[model samples]
Structure formats: C-alpha cells, structure tokens
Target: MALDGTGDERFYPGYDYTAPSGRSGGTLEVTETAACSASAPTDLAANATSPTQVDLTWTYDGTNNDYYTIYRGGTQIATNVTTGSYTDSTVAAGTAYSYTVRGHNNTGACDSADSNVANVTTPACTELTPSSISFNGVNTAAGDFSGASMVTPVDLMNLEFRVTEGTGGGAPFSQTDNFDANNFGNWIPSDTNTSNNWLLDANTTPSSNVGPSGDHTGGGYYAYTESSSGSYPETYWLTSNVLDGSTYALNLDFWWNMNTDTDLSCELHVDVSTDGGTNWTNSVWSRTNNPNSGDVWVNQNVDLSAYTSNNLEVRFRTISSSWRCDTALDDIVISGPARATEVERLAWNPDPQEASAILTNGNSYNLYARGTDPECGTVYYVGGTTTPGNSQAFTWSSCTETATLNAPTFSPTTTPITGPVTVTATGTATGIQVSWSEDGGATWSAWFANGATYTPTSCITGNVIFRAQGTGTCGTLTAQSAAAAFDTTDKDVATLTTTNPSPATGVVTIQTAVGVETAPATLTGVSVTIGGSSACNVTGAAMTWNGTTSRWEYSWDTSACGTSAAETTVTIDVTGTDPDCGTVVNAVQLTGVTIDNTCVDGTPSTITIAPGQTVGGTAVDLTTLFSTTGNVGSFTYKINGTTVTSPWDSSAYGTTGPQAVTFEVTGTDPDCGDIVGPVSNSITVNNALGTDAGVAGVASKNKQLDVTAP
Candidate 1:
C-alpha cells in the first residue's frame, strides 16, 4: 500500500483490494495500513550496573520494527538498537535517570509510541580507604595541640601522616600478618585442583623431608603448597585481599622454604594485580629453583611502590613438576611510609585550628581512614570501618598539656659575676611566671614575676647556671639559659705610700698595701711610675713583697731624675692587682725632691809672678791669689815641679832664681762627685844671704879679700 501527498490511499497496479461481501454497494474502505504500523515496545526496565553504567531491558510484541531507540530523561541516548536490551554507559554516578524505548521501521518511516517509563539511580563511586593508619609522630600530651579543636590529615608523597603537636615531626606507617591463627585471614587460596590447594599448617607439610621443619614464627601456623595429594604439573595460588596503594609506597615481606627436587622444573612466582585480581599482568618476582638447602626458610621482600592503585592485590603462585616440590610460606608482612587519618594529621599541627574549642580531657577519640583517587577523584572509605569510627581509639588526658616557654637571659653576660643580677624571660603564655635555678640547675628559687631580680648567696663558688620556668593554665614549662659564673672570695682595696716623700738623689722605697696587713688577700703584682717617664717606672719582680713589713716595696731609683740645682716636684703612680679584686691604682704628687749636682770651674786658668825674691825673705800666698767658682776644700803648692807646702821656705832650695810654682785645689759637690782647680806662678827665689853666704869657709876667705878690694 502507498500513500500519496494528498493523504489518500491508493492501490498498486499488481495488487488487488476488495471490500467485504456485506457492503458491496457502499464505498470500499481499507484499514490494512493503519493496522500494519510498528508496535510500541512494552515493559521497559532500567537498572544501574555500576556508578557509570546503566543496563536497560524492554519487551516487544510486534515484529514490524527493524530496530529500537532508547531515550534517557526525554533525550535520545541510543539509536539503532537491534536487540531488546541496551546499555547506557554515559550515565553519571549517584544520578537519577528516566528511560523509555520505541520501535521504528526499517526506513524510519513508521514509528510506534513510547514504551513504559523506567526510573533508576546509579550507585556512587566507591571511596578509597587505606588499609592502615598510624600516629607515630603525634604528641598526645595535654596542651600539645596548642588550642586546636579539629584535626585533619595531610597527604605526604606515597603516604599520609600527622606531625607532632606544636611541632612538625614525621610519623611512619606499619602493618603485619603473622598467620598464627591457623587460618588464611585476608588471603584467598586457590588451585587448579581443589585437592592441591595451599594449606595453613602449624609445623610442616604432609610429606617428610619435603617442607620446613617449623614455621617462621616459631611454633605458629604458616601457609604452604602441599604436593602429596595432587598430580604433577599442578599450580596453586594464594592472593591477598584488596589493598589501597593510593597514598603510600608499600612493601611485602615473607619467609618461604622451597624443598623441591633439583631435577624437576618447579617454579614460584610473585605477581601483582591492580584491578582487584581481575588479571595479573605484572610478575614482580620469580624463582625457578630452591633458594636455600635443608629446611631453612629464606626471607623475601618485594616493593609495590610502582603500582599505585586503590584495588591492589598480591598473589603467590607455585608450580610443581613432581611430588618432591613443596613450597612453604610464613610471616607475611606489609608495610609503608607512615599514614594517619584526617583528625590524626591535624592533631600534629603546631598551631590550633580553632581557639574556642580544644580536645576534651578524658575523652576517647576514634580514627577513620579515607583517600581520594588520583585518577578519577573518587573518595573511598575503608571497607570494614564505620564512617566515624575505625579499629583504633585513644583517650586524652589533661596532664599532657604544657605551656611553651622560652629560656631567660641574664643582665650581665660576663662570667665571674660577684653580685645580684636581673633575669628576663621571653615567650607568649597566659599568667606567665619565672623562676631561677642555681647549682647547675639542680635547684631552683621560688617563682617570681617576669624580669625579676635574683640574688644568689649560696651558689657563689664554681660555675653557676641559671634557668627559668613559666607556669600558666595549660601547664608548667622550664627553659635553661646559658650559665653565669661567679667567684665570692673576698678582695681588699689597694693603697700606696712612700716613707721618704722628700727623697734626695738616691733610691726611694715605695710601699703598696691591700686593706689591713692580716687580711686574707694576695697581691698579684704592683707597678710604680715616678716623674712621668718610662726611665723612672718600676714594675713586676722589681717590686718585692716585704713579709716583715707586710707590704710590697719597690726601690725607685731617683738618680734617673738627673741633676737639678733646686728641688724638683714629680707625680708618683702605683698600680696593683689581687686574686679577688681585678685592678687597683693610686697616684700622688711628691714634693721637696732635691737633685743638686752642679760644680763651678776656677776663675783663673793660671797665675804668674815676674820679680824674683829671696827664698827666705817672704812666703808667697798662692792659695789666696787663685780663686774658683766652687768652694775650695784644700790647696797644694809645688816649686820647680817639686811638692811643697802652701807657705814655701827658701831654705829648702840652695839655688833660687826664677823658679816655677804650681797650686792645685780640690772641691766637693753634693750631686757631682768632685771638682779640681790648678794655678801657676813664676817667681825667682835666691838663697837667704845668711844661710848660704860664700859657700862655707872658702867663701869667707874670698869674701875678706873681696872686702879689702871694695
């Protein structure tokens, strides 16, 4: 049948159409085209198979349609569905959807009405949960939270953990399975033949000389593949439950004993599956022969850090070529970097998240683990734990909270302090108080206000250490600063004096004394300076301690002061030190110091007399004639270069005519040792006439003759 553009039905040339026999005369009517249209699909049903997929099914009575079309929420999702069932993989997790189906003809020219509506909601994507959580580095003591209320976990590379409260110390994660319960625990054991499966035994395998003498855990159960009841070339597998590896680098450790025949081709394989054991494509470790001899068990470790999956699984496969091969496994342990729950991680923060509320004392806290998928961003809670609680809980106590206080500083940082000092503390805390400790911090003084003065009387000897403590509502905290040293031995003041204040040109003794003579003090050294010159300074060993006088005496050489005609004034300075007192100095001006050492030369260099005189007629006063600038003590006279007294006598010389006379005078000076002067006189001296006339008797006869001639 065909329809024209005018909506009128027409018969083809090769087909015949006839009306029923009851109405031959009336206009013929045909309803064949109206009844030949495709039938509508019925009983449509939609079901969500997974978070991202929805399976749809429907029933169809008529076969006039060539294909089916599916619509989700009034929108066409699939077309040309040849079968009654269709899968819509474009749905979203946790979303509600409405679906309907319709039948269509081969050319899509004729179509049926919409089928019954089907409603469905897709399940949410599974949340990732960690297999283990730890709080290894968290400080659980009171006041450790620093006023924080809520704790949150932090994501570390390949792991998660919480830092120490008020400090960021790292925490580690750990997990283990000893298999002492004689059961597989979370491990799934399977084999090609049921009779040849892996078994958990206490001591050894069924066959003698083919298995471990004992389990790795020492008198505990271990998993092993028994070859006694199975045929050759059989395979056995032991797989672990799903493990979450999204947050941590994981490692597997186990002890195994392979007592297999060296001639047989037996093998043991370790494999990993990322899709919950659907297919294991990664063969991490494999052993073709026995790793050790006898019944000794060898330890094996495998790293699972490369496979980061939420549904990670490990499997152990054993293939035995004969009954001589028996593989034993024990002490399986899984471990990774430390991990913690959100609350546990947050507890480790140094600062508080909220100041208004804090962790309650004596209250138990529950921990739960959760993770986000790096690939799809889906959150998965731990499979076996409740939403707010897990397998671990801890009780909090108020005793663990302590205030944070800093060390105190002293006003005088110099060692050997002798008096009281001020101590100042630095930090932030309520009701802060400070205390001090002496005796190397073994004992402490009473609490005082911040920056308080501390007087130490008992701990005056040796090294003294000072510490401070602060107390508040949270608790008490102590901090020790660098030590302050002190020495309490008594030291006396130094004094200086001189016995001869008005010293002449000679040695002057300067005395130095500390306090009283009997005082218990030691004079370490002494120095004295006079006339403000280095030449007159005396120090060190030059100043000798006089025990008899109970004083330190220094012989100051005044000769270095030089010669002076008049008195000289000078300043004298004395400095000394003692064991107790550091340094002592004294200064004084010394008056009436005379240093006269001047001598005068004679006024005349020489003296001469021209006329000759009789030897005994008169004595020449040569000492009176010669004069000098300095006082003359004595004079000596020489006539003709011969020694004589100052009053010369002519009788001493027989011949006396033009004789040479010299006079010498000596003088004394207070400073300069001595002075000398000389004077010369030329005079003629004749023998006295009566003493030497005529040369005795012969001269008398000649004189008689000469007298007669006169």
Candidate 2:
C-alpha cells in the first residue's frame, strides 16, 4: 500500500526507495583458512625376499590419505592397502618384477610412477628318478633321456635336465645326475669292443682291443665289455662317499644266455681294492649249482664285510676257461650306505605344520608326478591331498635335503580377465571390465569396481592371473596380467587405477561423496568422489564446491597435466545433480582461483523495430503482413547480407508496407536473450509523421515507438 501522505503529492514506486538498505546476500570472509595437513606419501616400495616372493609396503601420512595402490610392471597388483605391507610369494621363480604405489583420499586418488624392479631366479637343484631301466638283446634304454634331442648345449658337457614340473623327485628344472661329475669314480668307462663282445651282435665289429678306459656310443647308444685280466671286471666301481672303516654288501645284475655262455664256466667273484685300485683282494662264488643259467635274468648279492676299506671293488672271472669266461653284463646296480634324494616335504597347503617336520629322516614314499618330469618316484599317493608323498628327507651328514611340495590350488572367480567389458552397473561409464582366475583356472570372478579402483573379497593363494577384456565384434578381448603367484592365506585387490590426491590446486578440497568404508576406495580426497576413501576434507560435507558454475571459483588449468594435477577421476551419473556440470572430478588437483570467466555475457544485442516500421526501403511490420521469418547469426549480418546471402536479409524479408529495422539475440547470451529480445523496437519515422499530422493529442509511448518514455 502506498503511503496515504503520498496522495497529496506525486507518488512513484521507488520515490521512497532510498538506498537499498536491508542486506540480502553477503559472503563470509575468513582471513586465516585452515586446511587438512599433508597426509599422502609421494612414493611406495616393494621388496623381494625369496625367489618367487615380493613384499610391498607403503607410507600413510595419517587420516589425511585414504588408501594406497600397488602396481607390478605396467599393471596394477592391488588396491586398498589396509595394512602397511603385502606379500606375494606364489609366482614362479626366475621371473622379472617391478612395482609402484599410489595414495587415495575419499573422492579420488593420486598415483605415482613405477618403482625400481626386483629380479629373481629359481635356485639350482638335483633330483633324479627313472621309473624303469630296460636293457635287452638288441637295444637298451635307461632313464627318461631316451627320445631327447641329439645336440646338446656346450655347458652341458655331462648332462641336461631330464624333466621340469612334477614331484617324481622335484622342481621342473631339477638336476638328475651330478653331471658336474665330481664324485671320485662317478664316471665309469665302458667297453671299447663293439662286436664279439656277445653284448654286441655277431655282425658288429669291435672298435679296439678291450680295456678299461674312456669310451661311449654316440647318438644315444649302449655297448658291453669283458675284463681280460679279470682285474676290475667292469669300468666303474663304487666310489666312496664313505670311509675305509666301513663294511658293506654288494649287489649286481647281468644279462646272459647259457647257450651263448662259453663252454668254460664263468665264475662270479667279489674283489676288494683300497688305496686307489693298486692292490687287490678277491673272493669267489665257485659253486657249480649257482643260478648259472644265462638265459634267465638273475640277481646276485654278495657281502664284502671281509674287505678292509670302503674303497673296495667287485669282479667276475673264469681263469682256466677256453672261451676266456665270456661274460655280458647289461646293468650293474649297487645299493649300500647310499643316500637318495627324494621328496623331503610334501603337501599342497600344510595347515600350521612345520615344513621341517614334514620332511623327516628317511621314509620313502612313491611319488606320482604327472605333467612332464623325469620319472614318478616310488608311489606315495596320487590325486589326494595338495601336499602328498611320504617324508623322504635326505640325511646327508652335510648338504641340505628337501621334499617336493605341490603348489596350492587356486580358486579364482574369473578367467582370462577381459577388458572394456560392458557391464550393467549402477554408476559407471561404458568402458572395459577386467577379470581373473587363480589356481589352474579353478574359479573365476570379477573385482568390485569402485570408481578408479577394484577390490577382490578374498586373497589369492597360488597362481594369480588377471585379464583385461572388452566388447568386440567377435566377443571379448582379454589381455592377461603379468604372470605372478601367491601362497595360501593371501589376499589381493586390483589397483588398475588407484591413488589419492591432496592439496588441490584451485580452492583445493578433498572429500568423499559416497560411503567411506574402505580406507582405500579408488581415487581419494577429491571434492566430490563417486567412490569413497577414508580420508576426506570431511567437515560434515562433500569437499569444496569448486566449479566454474559456483561463485567461489577454482582454477584447474590444463597447462601442466600429469605431475601437476593428474588424478584418478571416476565418472558417474547423477540423477540428483545439476545440469550445469563439467568434467569428472579430479582428486585435489585444482589449486587457487584461476581466471574462469563463466559470468554469462548478457550484453543486449536484440535491437528491434515495432510493427508498421520501415528501415531502408523494406516494409516490415505486423500491419504490413509479414508472415514468414527466418533465423540468422546476427541482425547486422542479416541486414548487410548481399550476394549469396540468406533469405533473412532485409532485401528478401518484410512482405509489405513500412519495413522495420531490428535485431534479435536467439543464439546470444541465454540470460540476456530472455530479457532484451527484439530490443530497440521502433516504428518508421515517415509513418509516425503521417500518423501525427492526422492526430489530435500528443503521441503516447506506444504510438511514438522511437521515444523512450517512463
């Protein structure tokens, strides 16, 4: 209600509107601004302890940082570092490895480049096992080296690994015979006689006179010989890893036929030679009724207790035989105070049991090692426990003994993890999803996609593998994560992209938008994060409202990316958000207020002409009947349009009478267009003059279209 006193005088709406008094809006200024202290670390490190193990650890500046991410090579290994350290001990030995670390706040994360690498190689080992030893009339084959390639590496002067992978004895590259051949009498000389040795066919010719020395059949072959002097009958004699004070039993097996046996009876004798084979002592098994039949295979055992030193040898001879005691021995095996290398400890995953205890003194067990190895050891048990086999520990007075332990089985939820998988998720962009499997692809599953990070519930035990898969024409393309392993009771998180950012650039404020349960959600400490990290700018709200739209502006200059302001940004949909949104939030990248001129340029540009107005020579107005209209970039452009000009030009526009001159702001500033559209409206001066001459009273504001009236 206007004041009654104003009735006596002229009253204006704003006549009493002195200076706008009552305050409507004002900013609360704070001189001293408090900020969360620095919390996240810039670097992380992982160390290698064993051949196939890596221990990763990082630093946390306190509640200021959310979580951490670890990477191996270019691939991320784990996110959400609840504890300070992590151990990966399941990968195969002899592989190369590297790692990196990144920290996380609630909103997003800050990542670091990869760390130095940790290289490891498996240890050298020896464990020989041959299921069967066969030697007959024509050809003979011993050990698994039968079908092996003829050519060998130069370093392998004595041997090559029989097999890799399996517990027949042990490791994939386990050594069989110590081809490093250091044992005193390890290398036994063979007979040089190729023919007439009876062990050779009658058609075969002898290469040289029979003697004990160095000789061999190339191209994977075997030959035989006889002792003419009846000295050390065969080439190799038991070398002592023992002492001279020890007594022992000698065992031997030979192949011969009574028909081939010389008319002279070949006698079996036990010879003892100590002090380097110079002096000799011999014993005889002269019984005529002996298992003498050559056709049938016979095993002979003799006691050498009467020998003085452990350096004793055995021999066979027919002194006065006409056929020179023709003897043919295929294989001669000796078992005495011998130490066997076998499975010391066995188990896939032993429960709280000491590994040392599992490998006891001397208890042999059959080993059924499948999947390519030398030969299965004595059968212990097949297809049973993860760690099978009996305690076959080596009791060397010196060297270490170990039993084979089968690797624990893995149960992953995913297989060959794919990338860019289109999954129907709650809030995520269309991209690829990665998955993985452990234990020989036993189980397969996906990681929980949390913004820029993913975490698997349980840990991985043995083989851990991940694949990046994506949608393609054929199906899905999955790229494998670097091959690595772990042991039982191991847990892992995928840190494909995990890290925390702190001390933002523009009005920097780190915060968590979602639930802050995991200390290590994807990116952390961002103003508004899709995923939540433990550390946030949490003053009972999302970080800072830092955007070009807000009055309190922030600077996010893209001049210096990467190291300057690069952070993990996980994009998400916002049904409950504002339409004037910008790019996905970067952790705490923005620093101070940078020039962000988002203040809409609402300068009036829509100058208009009223109806029954004329400009130039064109008639344009409502009374003139101009029905058709068109849009143009700028009214000036429309007015000045010439050859090859749009139909909106004044020359082609207005349909009749007085043409009006005007401008519009259809595509101009949004706010200004709504208010000042068709501005500067006016009628033609000639038409106005004509109407004035015919009028009686002063022209009103509407009639005097060119006049500005209150």
Candidate 3:
C-alpha cells in the first residue's frame, strides 16, 4: 500500500484514503468479482458398456477448475475434460447414449450446471462362430475303396464301380469274366471248365480271392458249376446289359461264395428278363446254402426298382436240386445315379509342393487331372464352359487323369545342415503333383500341389542333394520321394582355455578353441579332474589339435596333501571327432577351476588367547599366533571349532568345562594365499579325576597335556 506518501498502509473501512482525493469521492465504490463459478461435476455415471464404447465417469471438487464438457447424443462430444473418464467412442451399436459433464469456470463463459445425464445403452452385437466346410482332400478316398462313402469334388456322382478279378483262364464270358458281352449261352460241355474249371480258385481265406468292397481289380472269382448230373430242372443263365430299368436307381452289387456237395441242392438266382435272352423271371433274391457252405464272402444288394422293363435283362442263375455245386462271383457293383467323376479339384501350377522339393534326375512331369461335375447330381449331361445347360440338380462329370513323376523324394531336417538348406518331402498323394531339386538332382522347381517348400539361397556343401517328383492320379511316373543328403563341412566345436590364472599343484595348460576346416578334427578325448580324483596327468600326444587350437598338457600332482594346505578344483574335458561327419562328437567342459596350492599366508584370524584363565590342563597344545610376516605351512588345531588333526591329546578332549581353542595357518606356496589363523584360544581342562587309573567307582576321564606356547 504505497500510495506516493511512502507508506505501507492497511486499514479497511469501506473506501477512504484514496477515494477522498479524487474530487469525485463519496461516489467511488467498486464491487466487481465474477468468473470462477465452477462446482458442478458430480457423479455423472455410465462406467462401461461396449458395442461401440461408452464409459463416462465424473467427479470434480472445484479448485476453480476450468476444463470438462463431454456431451454425447446431446452433441458436444468432448471439449476440454481435464481427466475423470470419458470414452464415448462415437457410440452406435444399438444406440441410445446420452452423456453430460460440465465444469467450466475459466472463460468458456462461466459453466457448472449440467452434471448428471449419463444414460448408456450400447452392447448388443456379438455372435460369431459358424464356419466349417473344408475338403480339399488330396487323395480324397478316406472312404471308398473299402473306405466307404466319402466323395469329395463337392459331391461327385456318375457312380459306377465294377471289379472282376476272375480269369483263372479266360473265355467263359469275356470282360475278364463275362458280363462285358454276355458270357453264358449255357455251359455244360463236360461240365464247364473253360479256363481252369471256370474261375474262382485263388482262395483268399473263407472266400475273398479279393474284392470285398474296395472295388476290386485283381483277384479271382466267377465260377458256377452245378453238374454231378442229378440235374433237377437244369438251369444256368447269366445276363445283363439291357439296362434302363428307368436308369439311375439300378443298383446291383455283388460278391458271393459258395460250394455245395448237395444238401439244399444249390440254387443261387437273381433274374429279370423282359424277353431278350428269351424270358426269365425269379426275383426275390434266392440263395440256398448247405453242402458245407465253406467259402463265405457274402455281400449283395439288388433293387433294380422292380423292372419297369426297357427290355431290362439282368440275370445270374444256377438251379440244381441235388448235385456237386460251386458258385462264386466277385465285386460286380452296378450303381446308378450317373454323373460322377470329379476326381477332386486339382490345380498345380505352383501349389504347395515345395517343401524338400527337388526334382530332376529323370524329371518329366505332365500331370493333369481335371474331373469336375457333380455339383449335386441328376443333370442328365451338359457340356461345360460354366454350365451351358444342365440342371436336373447338377452333373457334368469332367474327366481326365494324367500322371508322371521321375524325381522327388528327398527329406531333410538336418543332414549336415550348416548352409542354406531347407528341404522337405514325404510320399504325398491325392491327385499328386510336386517338383523340386537343388542341383544334385539337376534342376526343377515349380509344379507344386501338396504341402511343399524349398530353401536354397546360399549354403550347400559336399554331397548336397535333394529330389522330388509326383504327378496326378497315381499313374505315369507314379510318385517318388527319396533322395536327401546335406553335408556342410567345416565342423568342430570345443572351447576351453587355461594358462594358470590361479591354478596350483603343477603343469596345467589345456587350450581348445576349435574352428577346424581344412582337415583337422580328431581330438578324440582328453580329461583332467579334481574332487573325484585324477587331477591332471595327460602327458604327450593324446591331444594336440593344431587346425585352430586344441591342446592338453596336464601334470598337477599335489603330493597327496603333504604340507597341509592344498585347495583344488580343476576340470577340463574335451572330445572332438568330426572327420567328414563320421564320428560326430563335439564336447567341452571347464568346471569350477580355482586350484590354489595354498601359500599366501596372511590376515583375517586373530585370537591370541589369555581371556579368562584356565591352566589345569592334562593336555592342550593349542598354539595359534600368526604374526611372523608371511609363509606358513601348518597349524590347524581346533578344539571348540571342531578340527583336531595333529597329536590331539587330552584323551580326545575330556578335561571338561570351557574349551574353545582354535588355530589355522595354511600356505604351502603354490599361490595358496589367505588363511592365516582361526586364531581363537580358550582352554579350561580341569582334568585329573580318576580312581586308580582304571576301574572302581568308574570315573576314568583321561587327559594328558602339558600346555606351552602361549
């Protein structure tokens, strides 16, 4: 308050001193104070709820505070908001948000009125987990060649599966065993034995020369003889190929086995002729079984839809009331619903066949198998460019199968792997197609389609080789995978170095760094132990390796522990053996190692005795006083510290009450520094308590000491 008169004044009584001098006094009254009205930011809820985010929290106590203005749905969005909680990320998922928080007071034009309006409603959209339909199926089949019903190409179906395996001799019916051109005009010339009695002899256990269901292709069947001549209405027919029972549902399926000496006589028939082979009828599927019924293969299925007859001829008969019979037949599957040859999506320009992909030795790949058409079935037949006109449901059945493979069978995880070599391969299939070769195989790398990979950017040394070759559908070159070898040379590993940093006992120089390249990797073994005995003694020639460094010269003998003070801990084992990767051993160990020969006699042990009188000894030669400068060799006689190793008299310590004598003084010279004295002394033997030096009253506590050297 220095108003010109140099006076620091302070006395308030409602306008005086300065107002009275301005001529216009008496009317000079000022009252102005308006800006900090901030105190309205309490509670404003809505902690968290996400679909799009809301989380808005409030609570401010008014320190004249200035920032905070988050409103959503009501518009503002966020102005300053000096920290409380305001997430509101544009809110929108099931909408309904309304947050408000105000606390201005610092020029946003006086605020502090809107503090509670946080009604949130966002969360309501979270449902994701419904995807599955993967069937690339390389070999597809998982169920079809005996692996039952697992069609891939998205639903394929021209569905025809025929297997014969008959021909014990051929010429009874053709197509391997009749049925391809009608082979039964009725045989009976000498009782039928065209090839070897009509086929059906390979004998595969109780009835399967082969062909149970895997759609057979190589095993005998089809033998139907019934002619001991007891002939009860002789009948033998075998026909088929007039089809059209209305197509598509024709199912025939077969696989039977039989042999009858004569019981029920033998009758296995399934007929339906609309008068082409000249009338034949007897459906109800017959089979009699008797005559020891040995062979047992049995697998049948015949609906034929009741034969609406497009002249439908389908028969297989044999009726003989009592005679020597034999009736067999292998896989005959007729299947219906045509239109199914989609093999299973195959594309191989550079698909996945690269892992360990090496191919070239006899490389010749031209695999192409495009077979697609059963988007679902029934389509009657339509060309394909993208469905020209075919929609009974779906059916085109594109067909093409080509395969050829000559080189590809190299597998590698590590065949001397040191350089750039990432090879992989393993008998792959399912419309196969692969190609790879890294040099030894000559050249190839680009026809992949089955989990492939190849890595060869730099390193490849010595016998390095890799090969692979696989072509479609199991044909042409078929599929190969077997040539992988890598040998990156320059191998040797063993590291150990020592020249006596703090060792003792004697000669110890064992070095080994190992880099070996231009021939030199046979160290083969060298050791040096410690605690378990045998600490050095590897003399001349069993170790030296000079390609980079490898040596062993041990001879540390501490004389068994003579001068008392021999600290030890030395170990160094090494073994290198890698001559072109033959024995492959690379080891190195250096353990503990701190061998000091005990000889730096000094410091840390002070107990010069004389602390509480005790001189009634029968024996207590405890002498410890390390102060002669240096070089000490023996002196360790503890009584209460527990190490009594030299002429420890007093009859094994018996002069009772108060005995704590100590002494220590190591240092035999091989750098055995530090260990002067467990210098503590205390002895109160109080001996002399006996009863005649022997028996009687039994209190013979022996002691025999004299005590000197204080």
TM-score of each: 0.29, 0.24, 0.22
Query: How well is each residue in 1-710 modelled by candidate 3, as lDDT tens digits?
Result: 22343333445544545423433423334444554578766577885465656787777655766688876533365788787777875554554444567778775468776665555556665324211111111222110121111111222233222111111111111112322332433222222223223323343322223112211233433444434434454555556566655433366766555545334456677777766658677754776543233334445667775565556667677665444455656556554543222222212222223212232222222122122223212221122321111211111112233433343443345654455434444443344455544443334566666445554433235333333334445332233333344555444433444444245444444554545434444445544433422343232224555543444444455434323444444444555554444454443455555554444334333223343333333333444222333344455555565676543454433344434343333332223444444445344443455411121122223332222221
lDDT of 1 by residue, 185-239 (tens): 8788999988778887887677876777778748898888888767778999999
For candidate 3, the TM-score is 0.22
Whichever of 2 and 3 has more TM-score, that candidate is 2
TM for candidate 1 is 0.29
- Superposed by TM-score, candidate 3 places the C-alpha of residue 532 at a distance from the truth, in angstroms, of 13
Lowest lDDT sum, 10 consecutive residues, model 3, at 142-151
Which of 1 and 3 is ahead in TM-score?
Answer: 1
For each candidate, the alpha-carbon lDDT, in order, equals: 0.57, 0.32, 0.43
RMSD of each: 27.5, 44.5, 44.8
Please estimate how well model 2 matches the true structure, expressed as its whole-model Cα lDDT.
0.32
Give candidate 3 regions above 4 Å deviation: 1-262, 266-292, 298-546, 550-710
Q: In model 3, how large is the Cα lDDT of residue 635? A: 59
The predicted structure with the larger lDDT, 1 or 2, is 1
